[model samples]
Target: MDFYHRAGLILDALDNKKGSVKGLCMAEAKKGRKAGEGARFLKVVVEVLKYRPHIQHLLTATKLLAQEPTLFVPPSSTAAVASALKSGSAASANKALKTPRKHVKAAPSPLSLASVMVHDLLFAKRGLTLPKEHKVRKKLEKYQPALEKENEREKRRRKVATNEGLQIALPEKVASSLEGIGKGKKRAHDADRFAEEGAGSDGAPGEIRWMRVNTLRWTVEAAVEWLEKCGWEMFEDVQEMLAAAQSKPKVFALDAHIEPLLALPAAVSLPTISAYQDGRLLAQDKASCMPAWVLLMPALLDAEERAEAGLLYVDDEDEDEEKKAAGGDAKGKGKAKSKGIRVLDATAAPGNKTTMAAALVATEGINGRVVACERDQGRFKVLKDMLKRADAKNVQPMNVDFLSLKPDDAKLKNVTHLLVDPSCSGSGIPSRLDHLLPSAPEDEQLARIRALSNFQLAIVSHALRFSGAQRVVYSTCSIWEQEDEGVVMRVLAKKEFREAGWRLAPRDEVMPTWERRGRVEACGGDETIADSLVRCLPEDGTNGFFVACFVKDETAAPIAAPALPAAAAAADEGEEDAALEPLEDEDVTEDASAPAVSAQPVKKGGKAAKKAKSTASQAARKAKDEVLGLASAPAAAKESGDAEVKAPAKKGGEGGKKLSKKQMYLLKKEELKRKKEAAQE
Candidate 1:
């Protein structure tokens, strides 16, 4: 009836393997007990169990239980109680023990109840919240000093500084002896870890399984209710949810950064959940959701009228669906009025971001189209299947290399936004996840990174080439600076990128609350560039990831006058062009600084138009350089000193003479320098 009695009964059930710590506490709450009281009881039971081994050791070391024999239930009394409860014959076993509330003073205290009292006196910060006249309180007060002294002695023996330390440093022998002390077999380690600290003493946050509520099928509120109805308890704070999950079956918490996301215990069987199977809940990491959210929501939602001219809006008939997806009718308001917006997913395979973008666009009532392109045949099929499952009606899937698509083509010319998520080393994804890509040796890995970096840079540069494109969201599931910040640096260094009016979106327009920004050093120590990018590691409760948004400012003068010579401008072109080339019918010159002079009728804007034509000619020339493999000529010249390094002819034949030690060392040094330069490039 009382809190202590309730807690003792729960502990007794645990000892008898009747139920889990949370299950028993929840059972009490279901039986008309106050929710707060139930939580208190569960906390007490878990704390007692967590330190039960140490508490028992201390009790044995001090002989306190033996000295106060009447303070605990006897072995014979415990058996009689267990049998009475099991056989539904409480009166038959001990009629005198009926009505425990009135007779508790006369009966021996339950061993678990007595242990709870001892734990409070020795360890609880706010010790013993019971009345002074209470019999158990009076008994515990008598031996409080002795119990505290023994606890100190044990800590000193174990060389621990505090009670928490002593708990962590429990002797393995003592721990093995009480393997089932306070938690279920399935959650023994979890309980131990929770008791030590929320995420262990090292302070790395525990992994949480994140799911996004698919508003198309149900709202966040509906999803929450569905989970509760299915027996999962929700917590207001992620930390509290993690603690409860230690000895509980079903619990979840809302993600603070992303509104529509929920964090569940890692052990939850997600595939078996009805919501997941029905496609009402999407299995996605918090980091993976950032790109689409940035692209479709806060970043571009500011211009009300721009929505009409270029953005998409949901029809009034789909108003309720929009509200459901956005979490409220108020949030779903402000649909951009205008011609529908179009997006291109340059590397869209398996379509997670594609679906996410589609959802956000629909929820915001934006009239938008998403074109998803996958180069691989197998992944193209998977992308189509995902789009079908997600019900992304507006997306058009294509199986072709994104690089092969010309910006001026009819299919992509009107594309207003682009999502460029290309392949990388995949160092960000954990091995525990479904896929296990083979690892490469150090030398091969470096070479692979170089290749991947070039590819990523090329993809972003091509996205910037879309004349009608206003924004581009670039992302990768990679922790490497070379693939993330390195590619960003190279893109920003390009003459055409700025001429195209592309600039890194400010942090406020990005995911600002996200604490882990891109590596500042990787962005050449520029705080602004770093802030514009987002990064996630396992410690942040997501995979290692990097995402950045580039927005084209219409006010920017695309053909602004330059302050450089032609040769300097040509040499400053981005490195990605070395890995990209022009398609058929495009004419280009071999000279890096020479313009690809196409005799198209020049637009009649005079000086400004001529400047624009020259820029285009230069761009065409660079494209030709890529085709001719001359884009890397500058780097090669730097490495080999504008001429090939060669050994002089031998006295007899070319291979007949041996070189001196100094000459051999000089040749090796030059080779090493060339390799180093190649790596840097």
Candidate 2:
């Protein structure tokens, strides 16, 4: 059959299948036609008609081209035909007839013919024209160049999109409508207020897969070798990776900005590597590692300082015994030493930071431990599992709310490092698709941001109160100024923090190589403090992240306590001397005089009278203590007796006022009750 004859048969079959071109093609391919060839023909035809805006227009255009052989043939074929005719040779004409023309099939399916015609009309540089009266002719002419370019682009886009299972094109109207919505000529005046400020008209870059080698499990060399074996090439530089990714068959590269971080092609799926299941590799973002890395600053500096001082610090063999002595009281009441480093993850869950911190501690060979706190039961289980998988032995996971933890809690008394990565809006994560959902109303979003900021401030401020804490890293995966610098400013502005002796560590000191600093002007924070804050944007090859490191200034003077009053000082001095008096002699005299003193009525008076009254009060107190049988009192009994004696002193005069009948009766009733209870025991 001829090309036109076959095209007619395909189109006729499609019409009978209710314009189901894809179904007809699939049925034909199953019956005997080459599946790949039939599918490719169907794809080309579908791409050409995809943006025509009307099914009727697609069918009409397809039918017209399928029915007419001349309209579907290319100009080159026509020229050859003409040249053969002019030669006046039957042999040349016959040869021209026998040769199959470009884009023309000896047995073309209906869909294939339609594809050739559509390509000629919309994409091919030269081809047969449609009838002037055709309904789609004027529209096609109006948007001919755009449609051609779009169809050409779709051919390239399909390869990546198909493998990723992602949609490359929106419906025709939706795509066109989006173009009109945001194409304003005037730039937004407040663009600087947003974290996406410097992103150009193209907006942020696409997301990429970031893999970090778990130094806890596998060395970088081992990880690189394993990945290379799986057909992945590692690039030493990020620019090199970017350059290589522009070509085909996606590649992987080591992240230039962060250690042990590897970047894989955005659209490629990682091969199933055993190392991943074994926890030798983790799929974590470059920015997410910033907190743990920043937290390691002190330990890094300590090592450098030791090296400079020519100190070969060795671990003590008696370290366990020393620590046992150091952790003396169950209440953690003794002064905690600064010799060892301890970290607290205030809101740890899924233990990313916890495991990272633990790994750093283990790798650095530091006398450090990480205390990971998670309140959520479900997430806590996940955290424990992750820690186990990461082989994090230095982490102590606690299922408890950070807010419920007191600054002086025994577990936290020795914690000198803190990490607060609280919950936020997660507005900056592009993959989370926050942008696709209709945004919450502006007021609602602001309210939510404010609430989040308050929570962030509370947790971070609480972390700073730890007595031994010398450094704290506050971080969040939020892009909004309210959740980033706003929280920082509020915490710093509090009056109590003035004496905290801590300030946001200068950015140049923490990750000095990083160029993206916080948006100080937009958030209205102190310029120096804001400059010290760090921000990571989606365009920066990271999930949007904010981190601020606070370090205690050891040189800053400690806050002085208010002085005691002169009278209180004198009183305390007197009590110190009195505490040395013989207890047995005092108790002996009081016990002998107890009955007479209890029967006597006390008189209130001045100095000499006060002296007389004081003597009587002491005798009464000693007698009461003897009656309570507390002379050889246990610690618990002493504490209880002291409390009871102090309670009645609040209502007394200088001479010690005589007990009223009601007070005496109540005291006797309490004594009887105590005696009854003790006897029963």
Best by TM-score: 1
Q: Candidate 1: where are CA atoms >4 Å away? A: 1-206, 303-336, 432-439, 557-681
Which digits, one per residue and each the tens of the lDDT, describe model 1 over residues 502-532? 7889998888888899877677667878899
Q: Tell me the number of clashing residue pairs for each predicted model.
A: 8, 1
Q: Write one digit per residue (lDDT tens) for candidate 2, span 1-681.
A: 132233345554433322233323333333444424343334333333332232224435344543543443333354446567677899978877776667433333434455545545654334435567654445445445644455445546655333112223444432321222112331121111111111101112254657678878878788788778867767777667767877745567776656767777544433345676578876666777789889886686676576566543222233545567767432332133234567898777656677778877655436567888876555576578779989887788897767556676675677888988876655565533223222457765554455455446556767886878888998877788776776666555444554667677877667778888877564353456667888998778777889989888767873332232332233223322322221211101101111112423334577876776566555555454343332233452245332212223345467553432212423443444444555534
Which structure among the candidates has the greatest lDDT? 1
C-alpha positional error of residue 385 in candidate 1 after TM-score superposition, expressed in Å: 1.4
TM for candidate 2 is 0.50
